[model samples]
Target: MTAPTAPPPRSDAAVGTPPPTARPSLLRRVWTSYAFRRICQSVFVVWLVATITFLLMHLMPGDPIEIMAGRLNSSGMSHDQAMATAANIISYDPNANVWVQYLEFMRGLVTFDLGNSLTNPSKTVFEHVMEYLPWTLFAVGAGVVLAVVIGLSVGMAMAYRRGSWFDHVMTSIGSFLTGVPNYILIAAVIVVGYTMLGVLPFLDMRGRITAGVEPGFNFVFFGDAVFHAILPIIAFAFTATGSFMLNMKAATTEVLTEDYVTVAQARGLKAGRISRSYVGRNAMLPIIPQIALQLGTLVGGSIVIEQILQYPGAGQMLMAAISNRDYPVVQAAVIILATSVVIASLIVDLFLVRVDPRIKSEGQDA
Candidate 1:
């Protein structure tokens, strides 16, 4: 009997393949990556941000003591009380050095003790900022997620069906919507919401709902707040979605030209299957960092949308703090916002490296 034919030699060995290189351990690789360097840079940036924020707040023309007391002639406090309050507000004393004051401020941040609000002495800066941060996050968060989902999907579809009627339709709609500023859209939405839809009242700037009621799922206050949030959310989403859509379209268009995509199509892959599983998947890489960058922008920008909607969100607090020259509030807000931005960028950097190994390898080469 013919000798049993040896199973076909494995092509890798048949071609005299070299032994695989031993890859570095995950931890070691990460330690050497650009991401690690970026994180280190971020720590220095935070310190610099904190120092600059403190100096700027202190340098700005105006006294938190005067702002807090409401006047140089306020009758409630004697000279001693006023001086004590001023010292406390400024974190200074006759005996304390600048280093001491800065060290004390940094210590306070560790404990979430941001001191008293110069804009409103009835509350602490932490309380004032924390109270509104939630609402701002809610509004901005909802808008961003909505924009990404709607925009990316639309853009993918437009790009896939380039020059089709649907593509032209989306392009026109995106152009029109993007042309209108968020404030204008919010105004129109408010008018229609109140006058036409009769679904919700105008946004309340005084605070989220009347002060007495707690925010819960079952209350009219909550309902009213959500209804009011809709217009601002829509306005924010509309203005932002167009950019996401345009970017996604560009990314997807580039991805669709890859040889792998053509090969998949030749292999009898369904159009929908290839689009979602292949093209769309790869196209999302660029979008990831972009989304993080947008998050930073939105955090800084939420105040504008919040003000327009008369929403008692972080934006409103920022506006009030700026108008009153409440250095404490302004400094705290800037530090918090700046720290967030830097952290977001760092997270995005790491995420991109994780999603695309090329980033890590290329970074090493660089």
Candidate 2:
């Protein structure tokens, strides 16, 4: 009764103006979000990788300390002094329970302390990573970019020309290239360019740059770096382009058959315009995700290629670390690689969600 009486005196602002819209809190929004789940999944992936890497390193044959001691002995230290140095270098009790070591490793990760190199206790894991990561990024990045460009052009041409001789010829080549391993491709390139043709004297068969070229921001230095990187880039691009071409061709072929493309054709749209705005655009959707996902593999995939080329990249560093049984370096490299893959996958997932509404819908549904 009291409320009914008060209703007559209700303010116009309260009655006419709708109640203020209640916005969700940021924390609440994130807690309930698909993106948040994906992020958590990525974090879990990193943790799993770190854990596995740590366990494997510990389980592998030969002690890192022993390996270090042997190297120290070879470097002129007395056997006993080498043993002591090895112990000092490790700084932690290798005989400690595996769980304790894992906890320490996790703690170091939390603090961004990847520990010092077992072989060279003076240099930290981060230092080594920073030293090697850039070269890999440069060579691998150049390769990926070139591969994408070549693939898209070739793939689109094939799709448009379908059963033409050009299409058949390219498809066959792509198939052949895709079947060949990256190392095999690298060896073939080296053989063909340096051995058979002998025309590429500028192609540095080893190292990222000329040995005496001082590292700087100068054109000469950068040009030298580029010169050294050419063969590796070509090798990586040749190995990768085939997959991209095949994927793009398949995607383009499928897209061309869609009703919207058919309707666009019936409307007498220009071939170029239709191809660019309709067929090409739609076809690229699948390829975009592939490109994003492929970024992760580029790091790991470069290992053999880098090893063969003697490129001073992360892959080469990783190989060196493994050979030396450098625990900290190996752990750090694995972590970096795993993190990269997880991050790439996360980026692609988020990108797909934004660009393709269907992905968002599916995420919401899940």
Candidate 3:
């Protein structure tokens, strides 16, 4: 029997054209993108923060117009005149529909035009914010940097000497300090350093700079500003450093017990090298994101600390605005602080992906 007629040779075209690869759906592609999710989350967070702040301010007990009227009355205006002037200055009808005001406010936010302050109509809210932003940035930025450095070093050392007296002492100190409120710490510094010992003669307890120093980019101004900032920085750093140190200590302790650490030790790696490469580097990963978050929070000046020190910063401005019931100033400050936090978190999320590619993989899988 003619050997079962061999099947006709398959045409090359039949084999050459592979099944068309399935293209990813547009929705699937978007959902899987790390940047897309992060941006959406950030937008949602900003909107939530803004909306909540607006609602709370509006629903609060005191009336902004009444508060302004009281201030005008203090400035020697009759009750009727004060109310009329308050209306003129604010130019916002308290009798207007709440929804209408909200729409106007949202419009201003979209345009980045935070309107003028009711208290100081001559200068815009943005002007007030700019005037105080730099001081807060300088003091808080310096404090955060100092805290990170001190905390990382001390924490690593504590981890290296776990169960030793050094570790116990530091841990106890950090725990105690972390429990103390920032305002309390500032008060203590004022009482002990200024009131009790009178040792810090050079310390300017109030304001960002000494009274006579001209505002310019010179050694005198620079030195005076730094000198004035020393106490506030110390207060901030001391309280903040404790939390950082404790966090690092815990992270390091956990990392030191990892399999790789044991392997490094078993391989007879130098202690310093093992600590640097296997322990320190890995331990720092958790803290790095925290550092970024803290730096972001620094934009919102420590309200209690700034108020106590009378340092001209955003916190001080906010406190003043709240007292005066200046809606624009208050809203702008909250928006700026909230926006900074959201943006910082977004940046840190992206940065973490760069620092560790595994994060990107994990994000994709999620």
User: Which candidate number would show the highest lDDT if scored against the true structure?
Assistant: 2
Off by over 4 Å in 3: 1-31, 74-76, 266-268, 292-301
Return the number of clashes found in candidate 3: 0
Q: lDDT: which is higher, 2 or 3?
A: 2
Q: What tens digits encode model 3's per-residue C-alpha lDDT throughout 1-366? A: 557777788866778966667999999988888878999999888878778878877877776788888888998989999988888877766667889888888888888887888888899889988898778778877998899999999999999899999999999999987888767877887888778988866345568778878999899999988987886687677766988899989999999989999998999999999988888888888887887667665555378778777777888889898887787888888888778778877887887777778888887777
Residue 357, model 3: lDDT of 81
lDDT of 1 by residue, 305-326 (tens): 7777777788888888887777
TM-score of each: 0.79, 0.89, 0.88
Local distance difference test, per candidate? 0.78, 0.85, 0.82
Most accurate candidate by TM-score: 2
How far off is residue 48 in model 1, in Å? 2.9
- Per-residue lDDT tens digits for candidate 2, residues 1-366, read 355544467776866977668999999989878889889998898999999999999888888778878888999999999989888867856788988888989999989999888777888999988899888878877988999999998999998899999999999999987888878877876788788999757345578778789999999999989988887788778867998888889999999889999998899999999989998877888888777566766778889888788788999899889988888899999898778767877887788777777877787777
| Cα-based lDDT at residue 8, candidate 3 | 84
Worst 10 residues of 1 by lDDT: 87-96
